[model samples]
Target: MTHRLALLLLLIWSTPLRAAQEDPASAALAAMHQLEAATVALEEAESARDRVRAYTNTIRAYETGLAAMREGLRRAATREVELTRRLSAQEGELAQLLGVLLTIETAPTPVLMLHPTGALGSARSGMMLADVTPELQARAAAMRQNLEEVQTLRLLQKNAVRTLNDAMASMQQARAGLSMAIADRTGLPSRFTEDPVRTAILIASTETLAGFASGLSEIASGDIAGMMASISDQKGSIDLPVQGAVLHGAGKADAAGIARDGILVATRPRALVTAPTAATIRYLGPLLDLGNVVILEPQPDTLFVLSGLAEVFGKVGEVVPAGTPIGLMGGEAPQIGAFLSLSGEGNGPERSETLYIEVREGDSPVDPETWFRTDKDG
Candidate 1:
C-alpha cells in the first residue's frame, strides 16, 4: 500500500507539472507579460509616450492580453467539463478500486499475505497481485492526473476575471489617449485641398455607391502634383484594417438574400480600424445608405472604401501611412457577465460591430479578398 501510494504521488506531481506548462493558460500569461511590458514602458517615457504610435501599441497589447485570457478561460472550462465526464463514466470502477486499496491499507502485511487456502495457494494469489501492481498504479495515476487538471483549470479561470477587468481599464485609457493624439496631429502632407461645396453637392446628387465613388475625385480641388507610390505590387499582401470575423465574402449573400461587392467583417465593440497602406483620403463622411465612410485613393483610379464607422478621422485630403488609425467601430463594451457568456464559444470572431470594405478599380467594384491578407493565406 505504501509503495503504491508513493508511485501515485510521483506520477501526479510529474504529469500535472508538464500539463500545466503546455496548457492554454500559458498563452494568457504570455499576453499579460506583453501588456505589462508595454504599459511599463509607456509610463517610464511619460511625454514620449503620448503619441499615436505608442498608444496604438499599448491598445494592441491590452487587446491581445484580454483576448488570450478569455480564450484560455473558455478552453479551461470546456476541458474541465470533459475531464469530469470521463471521471464520471469510470466512477463505478474507480470506487471499487478505491475500496480494495483502502481495505488493503487498513490490514496488516502479515494478514494480507495470509489466505484461507494453504501456503501454496496463498503464494499463488500473492504472485497474481504482484503481476497486477503496475496496472493498478497506472489507473490510479490517470485518475489523479485528471482530478488535478480540473482543479488547476478552475483556479486559472477564477483568477482571470479580475485580471481582465484591469486590462480592459488600461485599454480604454490607451484608446482615449489615441483619440486626443489624433485630434492634435499635424505635419501629414496633403494630396489635394478639400472642396466642401463640391463634396456636399456630390453627396446631395448621388443616388448609388458607384455614383458617389465615381465622382469622389470632384471633391478634390483638382489633381495634386504627386501621388503616393503605386500599391499594385502589394495586392493580396495588405493587412486587414480591423480585427474581426468575416461575416460574408465579397458577393456572398446574407440571410436576407442581399449581396454586396464588399466583404463584411464583424468587429468587437469599439475595435480599431486602420489604413492598410499609404493613401490619400478622398472623402470621409456619411454617404447614401452607408454610415460614416472613409475613402482612400491609393493610386490613380483605384479606391478603397471603408464604411460603417461610428466616428471618422482625418480630413479628405490627408495622406495616411500604413497602419494609421482611421476610425472605430461602434458599440458599447460588454459587462463582465456578458463578456464571459458571449465571448469564447469557439464559434467565430467577435460580432459586436460590423465594417464594410470595398475595393474599386477603374469604375467597377472588385472582390476585397483579392487585395487583403486573410486567414486563408496562412
Candidate 2:
C-alpha cells in the first residue's frame, strides 16, 4: 500500500511538470491562430469601415502574438539545452545498463548464481539488477519524449517566421490601399488662388515655425462670423484632417528632438490631408524647417497650420468646407520604410511620413488632442 501511494504521488508531480513545460508553446500557438484570423478578416473586409476595424484588430493581434512567439522561442531554446543534457545523461545510463547486461549474458551459469559473499551476495545482486531495469526503461521513455519536444519546437519556430512574413506583407498592402482610398476621396475644388508673391515672402522671411505661423495669421481676411462661431462652439469634438495613428502629441519632442506645439500623425504615403473644420486657406507655401505648409482661418483670431505635405491642393484665401482636402502627405506610393514610427515596428523597408498640425488662437498654440478625434475615440 505504501509503495502504491508513493508511485501515485510521483505520477501526479511528473504529470504537472510536463504540463507546465508544454503550456507556453500552447499559449503561443493560440495567439498566432488569433492573429491569423484577424489578418483574414482584414483581407476579406469590403468596405472602408470594415477594413479600418479589421486593420485595428490585426494590429493588436499581431503585437500580442509576436510577444508570445518571442517568449515561446526563448523557452524553447532553454528546453532544447535541458533536453540535450538529459539525453546525454540517459545515453550514458543506457550504455552502463547494456554493459551490465552483456556481463550477465556472457557469464557462465554457475558464475551468475555464485557470489564472493555466498547466498547473501547473490540475493543482493539480483535485487540491484531488478531496480536498475525499470530505471533504464524510464530513462529511455524520457529521452524519446525529449526528442519529440525538440522536433515540435523547431517546427513552431519555422511556422512563426513564415507567419510574421505574411503579417508584414498584409500590413503593407492594407496601408497602400488606405492611402489610395483617401486620395480618391480628397477631390475638393480650390475656392481661392495661390499667391506666389506672398508665398515667396513667407518662404524667405519665416525663419522659425512661430514666425511662419504669425505671418499666416495676418494673411487672410475674416469672413462669415456665424460659421466661425459655430466651429468654435464644437472645439473638443472635431475630427483630424488625416486618418492614421498619432505619432506625437502636442508638446512632444519629434525625431529631431524639437518640442512641437502641435500633433504629428504617422500615415500612409500620399494620404489626403483635409480641413478639420470650415476654414479659409490663409497661407499656402513652403517655409524654412517645414515642408509645404497650409494655413487656414476658421475665425478671425483662430488659425490652423498644417505642414509636411508633398502636394498642396488649396490656394491662399480659399474657403473650404469642413472635411475638404487641402493637400496630400509627402511621399511616393509603396514607401519601403517605417510607416508609423510611434509603434516602433518599421513594417519592413516601407517608411511612412508624418503630417504636423498646429492650432493657434492669435499665436498661442492649442492642444490638438482636446479637439481632434483620436484612435481611442474612433
Candidate 3:
C-alpha cells in the first residue's frame, strides 16, 4: 500500500514539475513584451516622420512574431491537457492507497505502528501526494490563464495589423494626389505679362463709318435727314465709301463724338470670339475710348460688346460662343472713342458725344450695364 501511495505521489508531483520545466507561459509572455516594445517604437517613428518606412516594417515584424507566439501557445495547450490527465490518474490512485491505509488503522486488533522508517516513509509519501494536488491545480490554473491572455492578445494584434495597413495606403495615396496637382498650372497665360503686345486689324463697317461722318458734320442744318440721303442707299459693295484712318490723342467720352483728340494709335491685342447663346452686339468698330468694340448677341434681346481694343473678332452674321475672349486691351498707347446719336433734338451738340451701350429687347436700347461683366475690377 505504501509503495502504491509513493508512486501516486511521484506521478502527481512530476506533472506540475514537467509543466514548470516547459514553462508554457513563456512564449505568450515573450510575445507580449515584443508587442509592447514594437508599439512604442512605431509611435516614436510616426512622430518624427523620419521613420515611416521603419515603422511599417516593425508592424509587419510584429505580425510575424505574434503568429509564432500563438502557435507556441497551441502546442502548450496540448501539453497541458496531457499533464491534466496524468494528474487525474495519479490522484485517483493516491485516494485508493489512502483508503487501504485507513482500513488497516481501523482494524479491531490494533495494528502496531510499523518501524520508524516505514511509518515515516508512509507519512511522508501521503504528505507528498496531498501537497502535489493543490500545486498541480494551481499551476494548471496559471497556465490556462496565460493561454487565455495570449488568445486576447492575438485578437488585438490582428486589429492592429489591419489598421496600420489601411493608414499606410491612405498616406501613400494622399502624397500621389498632391504630386498631380502641382504638375498642372491651369489657366495661366502662356507668356510673361512683360512681353510686348501683338495685334491684327480688319475694317468691315460702312454704315458705322457713315454715321460717324454724319455725327462729325456739325455743319448740317436742322433735322439733317436730307443731308444723310446724299450719302447713298446702296446696301451692296458698289460705291463703297472711302475709309480714313484718324489718329487722335488721349481724351474722354461724353455726348458729342470722341472728345476733341481722344484717339491714340494702338496695336491692340487680338480678340477671341465664342459662339453666341444670348442676344448681344455682333460687332463694333473704330477702337473707341474703351477700345475697338464688338458686341456678342448670345440671346435675341441682349447685346454684349467690349470697347477698348483696336481689333474685333467675328463680323455681322458671325456666331460666337459664350465666354470666348472676344477682345483684349491692345495699344502701343492708350486710345478712346464715343458713340452718340441724338433723338428729338436735331444733331444737338449735347447729344452728339454721349456714347451709349444699350441692350434692346425689341427695338429699344436698354442700359448695357445690366448684363456686362466689366474688367474694371479685373
Candidate 4:
C-alpha cells in the first residue's frame, strides 16, 4: 500500500512535469508566471507603506490575475476530462479484443469448409482463429490506432491541464502573498474605515463621465452649442435636473475638487460647447460632477464649453454680447474658470461632442484668462 501510494504520487507529479514540456503546457506556465508577477507586484505595493489609492490599485491587479487564472484552469479541466473519458473507452475496446482472442483459442471449431478451386482451403482454421483472424487482426489494428489517438489526445490534455493548474496555483499563491504583504504594510483593519469622502468623489466622478457622455451626445446631435446660447440668453442655467460640483482647472484632467459652499461658481469666460442649432434642451440629471455644462458657438468657427452652473442664458445663433450670464455654479462650494488653453498632446483630439476647449487667435494659442474677465464675486 505504501508503495502504491508512493507510485501514485510519483505518477501525479511526473504527469505535470511531462505536461509542462508540451506547447500548451508551456504557454499555460508562461501565463501563470505573468499572474504570479502581477500578484507579487500587488503584494509589494500593499506592503510598501503607500496611500490608499496605491493599495486599492494593487488589490485590483491581484483580482485581475486571479480571474485570468480561473478562466484558464476551467478550460484545461474541461479538456482533460473529455480526453480521459475517450482514453478509457479505447482501453475497454482493447480489452474486449483480448477476450475475443482468448475465446477463439479455447473453443473448438464445429465444422470445416472447402473451396471449389482448392483441395483444402484451410487446414489450421481453428488455430488461425485462435492466434488472429483477418477480421480480428483488423479490429486489433483499429483498436491500437484508436489507442494511439487516445493516448496522443490524453497527452495534450494532460499538458494543457497541468499548465492551467500550475498557473492558477501560482496566481493564488501570489495573491495570498500580496495580501500578506498588504496586511503587513498597512496593519490593515486600521486602514478600513468609513470613506465617505471617497464615496462622494466616486459618485461625483461617475456623474462627470455621464455628463461628458451626454454632452458628447448633444454634440453628435448637433444641438449642444445652440442649446447653450439659448440657455445663456433665456434661463440663468440649463439644469441637468441634477446637482453636483464642477471641478474645473483647465488643461487635461487629473483630479477633482470638492465644494464646501452651496455652489461652485465659474467667475470667468469658461469654454462653452460650440454648436449650430439655437436651443437644444439636452437635460443633464442631478448629482453630476460636471455640475452644469453648456455648449455655445460664439461664432461659426469658435466653440465654448461652460461648466459650474445651474441655469444659463443665451440663444442659439443669437449674437450675444460679451459678459453674458451663461450660468452660475450651483454646488455646495462653487468655483471659477481660472484659466483655459489648448489641451497638451497625449489627450487625443476630441472625437465626440466633448471639446478640448482651447482659445486661439488665428494660428497662435491664446490664454482665455486674458480674454474673459472674472466677476466681482467670482
Model 2 stretches astray by more than 4 angstroms: 1-24, 47-50, 59-119, 126-142, 184-205, 209-378
Clashes of each: 0, 10, 44, 52
Best by lDDT: 1
Candidate 2 clashes between residue pairs 3 or more apart in a chain or in different chains: 335-350, 336-349, 336-350, 336-351, 337-349, 337-350, 337-351, 338-351, 338-352, 339-352
Q: What is the lDDT of residue 255 in candidate 4?
A: 30
* Model 4: lDDT to the true structure: 0.37
- Model 2 scores worst on lDDT over the 10 consecutive residues at 335-344
Candidate 1 lDDT tens digits, 1-378 = 133333332332233234445566665445445445545534432355337765665565555555555665666667878999999999999998888777766878888688888798889988987777667778988999999888877777666677667767777777887888889889888888988999999999999999999987788787775774799999898888887767889999966799999998878888888888888898898988899999998888899999999988888889988878889889987777766665447554346688999999999999998998776410
Per-residue lDDT, model 4, residue 97, is 81
Q: lDDT for each of the candidates?
A: 0.75, 0.62, 0.35, 0.37
How does candidate 3 score on lDDT? Answer: 0.35
**Model 1: lDDT of residue 374:** 70
TM-score winner: 1
RMSD per candidate (Å) reads 9.0, 13.2, 35.2, 22.5
User: Order the candidates by TM-score, highest first — what do you get?
Assistant: 1, 2, 4, 3
Q: What's the residue-level lDDT of 87 in candidate 4?
A: 60
lDDT per residue as tens, model 3, 1-378:
133333332332233323434454554444434444444444443443323223333333343333333433444445555656665556665566556555645755423433357879767765775676566556556655655655654554444444444433433332232233223313321111111111111222224422322222232223312111111121111110001111232244434555532232222122112222322233445533444555544443333333454344333333333332233333221111110011112122221111123333344343332333222210
Off by over 4 Å in 3: 1-22, 97-378
C-alpha RMSD in Å of predicted model 4 compared with the true structure: 22.5
